[model samples]
Target: MTTMIKTVDVTTALSDVDRFCDIPNARISGEIFHRQDIYEQELEKVFARCWLFVAHESQFKKAGDYIATTMGEDDVIVVRQKDGSHRAFINACPHRGNKVCFSESGNARGFICNYHGWSFDIAGNLIGQHESGIYENSHFDASKWGLREVALIDSYKGLLFANFDADAPSLKEYLGPMAWYFDALFDNQEGGTEFVGGCIRSTMDCNWKIAAENFVGDILHAGWTHDSAARAMLGGAVAKVSDFDESYSVNWHGHGYEFAMDTVGNVAVLGESALNKYLHTIKPSVAERLGDFRSNMIGSVSSATIFPNFSFLPGQNTIRVWQPRGPNKIELYTWVLVNKSAPEEIKEKWRKGAMMTFSPTGVFEMDDGENWEYCTKTARGKVTAKQDLYVGLGQESLLQETDLPANVYSGQLNEANSRAFYQFWSDLLKAPSWNDVPNRNVGRVEAGAAAERCSLKEAK
Candidate 1:
């Protein structure tokens, strides 16, 4: 039986959404994190319409190779065709609605339905049927019965994404100023970066936003939350330094970043010979291409979130996609990123670092997972859910429009980014379309001028 969801008054929700901008130093109500109705609303208003990261193009290297991925809760299969082009569509077979391909990843010229012998080409055309006579003289056009395609699909520097809303902005436009930072991380090297093998998949009993917010906004927790792990990995001076505060910045469209000094020198953790070799290989090239500031960040520790649900810590060489299963659960897809032109030994070391720091078995992952689960459990309580949670760490200190690149933050410990994320989140849940977002909250101050400089209108 289908459960009926009562329609929320969009106008009333719009008022609530606009209020988030004014509540700079206030706590957000905890109810937003646990309500089932709100989660349902998010599925339609946010997830369905947003440009979600699907998979890297490198994942589909050869023609016929494909990987099953998720956009919101919808299952999609991304395939590389004989012509070396790519396509993505709902994984369901049109005839019987059965999942056409069950494997997580593989190579296939076409997907054959297991229930009935209906088959679809990698391009999503229903080309074959077991019993052609079943339809007889009936007017059935196989062309009209092709697998459903995602309304909007595009890529950015090899990363593919799809949106259910056709009117949504192009992927590049949606990425906005975040692209500058992405180019810093991805395009600095000659061949750029590529995912190593497949992702490490795991499930967490926590709200998806909890994990995303942690990556995007909660740098303060690193020292305390991962104290034991940091101590175990690098003892004495490194452990002591890890306890110190860091600096953070918030970008428009809810993207944010937190940067910290090398608590342990790069040479100490990555080995002297290896660090020397890496510097020798990239220093001259980096200086020639991106200048000193970006080249310097190559080995530093930085965690960042790209609006909505994609995040990466380039210094750690880790990338994550948070797939919300429901309000109380999330499926995390983690990939190890390696400089495409790095020496095999260096790439291997980077992979090991990623596994040790963020994989499901990693010490830090265990620490954060426990906290995420506890947060969700606490929110389940009637009294607790009624209260609000604070995220106003350095609201007064947030950088207003300045000469620095887009909302350049002054400190590493501010909650300005977290607040920006929630502000966008609330706006998304309320507005009927992405175009309506700017007008609904026009007077609201945007800390990072990044959005204005890299307008989504130009992404296409």
Candidate 2:
């Protein structure tokens, strides 16, 4: 008989999540941050079904370079192949439960498990086992026990993503309209981007979603959260974000990206006069390579979360993954991405800038961590868990019909992106299987149709 653990009914809890995150009433139930059972369910349903960031291709400079990371709660090894493709494997020795790859990242010939002298190749094939004579009469099959490969792995530009559910849609399809904005950051230059610095990881007592949300469309927090840094740095033009109120986007998937339309917007946040100067110097080339809209975004400040937990600051060039530990903890891995062909000095400047703005001890990062930690703690009480938290800013009338790939809103200060994120979050939880999830194609079609109508009405 299957064990049916009970307390807060699982079905009822999921239904509540769906009911709360809907449009016209986009609210978040605090229990989402507090419930242990819900967190366990998310490990299987949400993480397993989603396309999650594993590693970047630039990290695989050589044939054997590999990074050991996580896909949701499961540890994974992302390795570069000799033929220029990538593979991800569950990081466990099939013989016993010991992790095969010990190091975070390095070029490896193969992995040898310390627990039982089991050896595996670069592609995760179990090649050797110690004391062959001891298992002569016992039934053990080496061929049947390679490190179990992750179901699917793919890359867009240089960012690698993996999904455990074989039936889930392709990474591009799952990304939906978010790809348009991603290209603005990734493919808008003459040469592509690469991860520059080594990883900076630190733990925080906050849910992964909290950090993801802050990055997505929480521009409202900037002038307040990083107020001191902005005042102290006072890099002339960078200080102008005090008046920012401009553009933001909401992807069909649960992704959120917000940016000020001001040309010097992003670099100003770093209090780095160098980035502002460099951006203006490269605008002509950026325009020629990526065309108008993307070129326009070149010097503008931007932040985005590629739903679930992968995020990046386009201006500052910081890319981070919020690796979930449990209901109230996460291990954050961050790296700085710069144009592969950028000057060494320019790249070095970005490294120092990222360190100042987002590294573990960085000012802005510390401020955001404090808020997320308290948000998680607040939900521990029964009364607070049931209270509906309002997140519906500009929900009913914010989205505007635009030429942009994703549905966009008119202002930088909006919560529509957060709403879309939570809506998709709810959909994934209630979806019985990948096939059962709501058809996003229909939503996109309807959204386009609505945009066209709005455009025609405005013309009249």
Candidate 2 stretches with Cα past 4 Å from truth are: 1-15, 19-23, 235-246, 398-400, 440-460
What RMSD does each model have against the real structure? 5.4, 5.2
Q: Number of the top candidate by TM-score?
A: 2
Per-residue alpha-carbon lDDT of candidate 1 for residues 207-226, written as tens digits (9 for 90 to 100): 88888888886777876787
lDDT of 2: 0.77
Q: Indicate the TM-score of model 2.
A: 0.90
Worst 10 residues of 2 by lDDT: 1-10
- Those runs of model 1 whose alpha carbons end farther than 4 Å from true positions after fitting are 1-25, 239-248, 261-281, 400-402, 439-460
User: Per-residue lDDT tens digits of candidate 2, residues 71-115?
Assistant: 888998888878888888888887787998889999998888998
TM-score of each: 0.87, 0.90
Highest lDDT against the true fold, candidate: 2
